[model samples]
Target chain A: MADVNVSTLSHSPKDPAKGAGKLDDSQGNGGIPAVELIELLFFAYRDFVGDADELLARLGFGRAHHRVVHFVNRHPGMRVADLLAVLKITKQSLGRVLRELVDNGYIDQKAGATDRRERLLYVAPKGEELARQLVTLQTRRFARALNECGPGAREQRESSSLP
Target chain B: MADVNVSTLSHSPKDPAKGAGKLDDSQGNGGIPAVELIELLFFAYRDFVGDADELLARLGFGRAHHRVVHFVNRHPGMRVADLLAVLKITKQSLGRVLRELVDNGYIDQKAGATDRRERLLYVAPKGEELARQLVTLQTRRFARALNECGPGAREQRESSSLP
Candidate 1:
């Protein structure tokens, strides 16, 4: 978004670690060189999630449903209580989203093995497929960023910058 | 929020390498081990932009202001059309939000130097301060997520699983 610097960007011959995070910190001297990584994170993320959103919308699903599906897929046997904690949404809201996800065959909710009251969650074939689609969409975006942005951009800057 | 990790949160790690662009194969991975990074991103992002929101609440500013501020700050000396392209909002809606941001002294405007019809933009000192505070608040959250999630945790399993 700003003027590009050959040294701050493009592969540096000086040291494999040189451009780490410095390119975006334009002013020189003591600025966080790693800011480049930050922008990449921001820009890449905006575009990355955007890709998934479009696909989800095509199927009449929204970001909320995608999030629910992701969590269920990630932790196959978690509880509703756990989902609530992680999502931090009111039960009423979660109920609406989860219900739709479950009803649509994208997710599966099983009776808790130990406590009948708890609902154990998993990604059913349908849910897994959609989740797979969304996550895969994002992963590709990230991987591309990683490849073009260089493998050790952040690592190179880590030694010189503060978090 | 699931079993996925947010380990490298709180202190922003030295971001290793981040990417940008539209070059996606659609089959890319988000690099699994680092799946937690996505969650950290979700949590930390929600938390990161939250403070400015609270401050804005006192002044009737909302997330729209945040988006406006973020973009303007990201590309200072940007044009209205350029901004509109980035935002993808209706002109009427955009006009309303833009007027509010300008009225609140959170942004400034000028006639384009070369193209008189083009309204160029910049963040006023007050606006810049607010944007800085808000973006920085989120920045730290990111720093922490990276640290806790570990540099390598999210490196591999990015794609074919998003959601």
Candidate 2:
């Protein structure tokens, strides 16, 4: 994951039109949307997921694995079909991640009693613990962002600006 | 490439605790931050890059390529070292992507005028076109998100809530 320094990359305060490293400072034609916001969104997402990505890397896992654990823990007994719909990933990809989790004792699979062909997923105790830790790491970041943004600020601004 | 349906995955409106697809309705022990927020962030980022990701795939490129093109276009004449610092990726990884872009006429590399040994990057005409398109697509989404969130709503909420 690329950790961006948005301020460093942004145009200099004194010379907004001429960025330090840029040769062609011409921002394309008029009516072009703000590039600053676009880059900000890009870097924000990169940094947001950096924490979980780092943790998963340490565990020899990846984003796919993290998604599996998070969702399965969130929706234990989730049907294979529903998981496929939610993830929108191929059966093959999900199969590989599921196998690793089950084999490693992070997830448990059981056949639906009523529908024997149905595959149901559940988080094992190990998986639960991992999910908790991941959630905690993410939750802390979320809280900080909310605090920085100021809760209800968007709503208040909306109402305040009303004509 | 996974597209998520956050609303569908969310806890039921009728019974906020129980969800349609979930078998275990038990959200973990106390002090755990909101899972909905966590999932929302996950899906938000997933969808945000999805537009560019889809376009990149058509050209046989990936996120790495998109990032390279974007930053290079933003800072033409940028040294390879500066790019490395901004991206925080392994040299080998960056080298592979850069090779593809240059080979395909999407990027041009020039030696420094002052220090001929220093490699400087510039987006080729084709690359600039692609960058513009990517920026347009992303800007549309960003604009929509701001509209949906209500522009300045967050700021207003922060001020109003203050004593």
C-alpha lDDT of candidate 2 relative to the true structure: 0.67
Candidate 2 residue-wise lDDT, B12-48, digit = tens = 2132332212212242223333676667566666667
Error at B65, model 1, angstroms: 1.2
Lowest lDDT sum, 10 consecutive residues, model 1 chain A, at A2-11
Docking class of 2: incorrect
C-alpha lDDT (0 to 100) for residue B161 of candidate 2? 17
Which pairs of residues clash in candidate 2, taking residues 3 or more apart in a chain or in different chains?
A: A153-B153, A153-B154, A153-B157, A154-B153, A154-B154, A157-B153, A157-B157
Candidate 1 wrong stretches, greater than 4 Å = A1-38, A151-163, B1-37, B88-93, B146-163
Question: lDDT of model 1 at residue B37?
Answer: 48
**lDDT, model 2, position B73:** 80
Question: Candidate 2: misplaced stretches above 4 Å?
Answer: A1-4, A9-34, A143-163, B1-4, B9-34, B143-163
